[model samples]
Target: MRPMPRPAEYGQWDELPDVPEVPTSRMGDLAVLDVRERLIRLIDRRRSEDARIAELEQQWRERGGVGESPYEVSRQWVRRQTTEGALMLAGILDRLLRS
Candidate 1:
């Protein structure tokens, strides 16, 4: 049998690179409005990333990829959980900003 494919090769979720920190000088200078605007933009960008990942997974499935394997199932579950957690955090931040 062929060796099992690596997660990256199969388009499985991989750890995203860390977002660069806001420079200390910039952070101190940002107004509350500026911070809120940046948060909104980040949330929007994250939604786009989630959509693109989902689309790629759908395409892989359409191609008859092995999605039913236990490993794959767990990987998908983890990805879903991570996405949900990020969304929850975004909602909290949005509410805080609105208050």
Candidate 2:
């Protein structure tokens, strides 16, 4: 069987540009910082959403009971998913940093 040419050999894709390598320690630090920032943003977003939900719920209460709000139910589902994703990401990052 004949071997197929690699993309680089055929010029199908341009070779990547040379870039200076970052130190492992520096890279790890950067990864940790990035994760922390992302987590913070995620938490802040969730908090804002929770506050909005609370406001809406209070307003609903002010008015006589009128079944459940579809929007609120969907928002709660989204919030739950986001929380789960954040927890998983944090766990993976923790394991990576530990190693």
Best by lDDT: 2
Model 2 spans with C-alpha error above 4 angstroms: 1-28, 66-72
C-alpha TM-score for every candidate: 0.41, 0.59
Candidate no. 2 TM-score:
0.59
Highest TM-score among the candidates is held by which one? 2
| Count of clashing residue pairs in every prediction | 0, 0
Report how far residue 62 has shifted in candidate 1, in Å. Answer: 0.5
Task: Evaluate all candidate structures by whole-model CA lDDT and list the values in order.
Answer: 0.51, 0.57
lDDT, model 2, position 23: 43
